[model samples]
Every structure is written in C-alpha cells, then in structure tokens.
Target: MSQDHDEALVRMVNQIAANLGPGREEADAAEGVCTHLEKFWARAMKRRIVACLDAPDGGLAPLARRGVERLAERQAD
Candidate 1:
C-alpha cells in the first residue's frame, strides 16, 4: 500500500483500538489496544518492519520487527 493508505490504516488501527469497548475512555482504550498491538505486532512482523524502518542493530529493534511480523501474520491468518 502507498504511504497514504499506510497512514490511513494506521489511523484505522488506532480508531479500532479506540473503539474496542463501550466507554468514554476511548483514548485510553486505544492506548491499551496500541500497547497490545506493539507487543503482538512486534513479534509478528519482526523482520520486514525493521528493514522498512532501516533500524540499526539493537535490542529495541525486535519490537519493530515483531510488529511488522504481526502485520504479516494478521494478513496470512
């Protein structure tokens, strides 16, 4: 997808996160969702995301890589 689509999807994901439960704390809800995403996604798309991000070698890089892997996993499954 193009950058625009990517951004839109990100926004959509954020929105999905925000709308997870029926409550006034939508922002908080989204944050919780995003947090889960970070964990799951980090493991899911570990490689592609790191390459796309051009991340340097480091321990923190796995989070990004796994996030990308998660995206792929989501697509395939």
Candidate 2:
C-alpha cells in the first residue's frame, strides 16, 4: 500500500483501539482491537500491518502495536 494508505490504516486501527479502550485496561482494549481486526479486516490488510510490526518507524500506537502482536500470534496458531 502507499504510505498515505498505510498511515490511514494505522490511524484507523488506533481509533478502534481508542474507541474500545475507554474505561478498560490497556491490555484488554488491545485484545478487543485485535479481535475486531481479525474478524473484520481483510487478510491483506492484516498482512500489511503485520509487515509493519518490524519496521523501524512503523508509527503504530502502543495499543495498535499490541493488537498487531496479538493478531500475529493468533495467525501463528
């Protein structure tokens, strides 16, 4: 995806995490975001985010990073 597209995806994921995170623990919110993404996002989208996980400047929010990690772990199973 283009850089703008990637940034938009990151922002969207962060927004989901923020929306789900209110009044909840950070870890719980991240898990919720991960679950939501896994169920709703396209496989290619997930793959793209996973690819960003290791980038030096992935630009992922803390919760977004955790969500990506959770998603990756689930995919590994």
Pick the TM-score winner.
2
| Cα lDDT, all candidates | 0.44, 0.88
Those runs of model 1 whose alpha carbons end farther than 4 Å from true positions after fitting are: 24-27, 43-77
The whole-model C-alpha lDDT of candidate 2 against the native structure comes to 0.88
My TM-score estimates for the predictions, one after another, are: 0.32, 0.90
> How far does residue 60 in candidate 2 sit from its true spot (Å)?
0.9
Tens-digit per-residue lDDT, 1-77, candidate 2 = 79788888888888888788889998899899999999999998998888788889988888889989999999889
lDDT digits (tens) for residues 1-77 of candidate 1: 34454444444444544355347364455345545665665443333332343434322223333344454555456
Off by over 4 Å in 2: none
How much RMSD separates candidate 1 from the native structure? 9.2
Top model by lDDT, which number? 2
Model 2 TM-score? 0.90
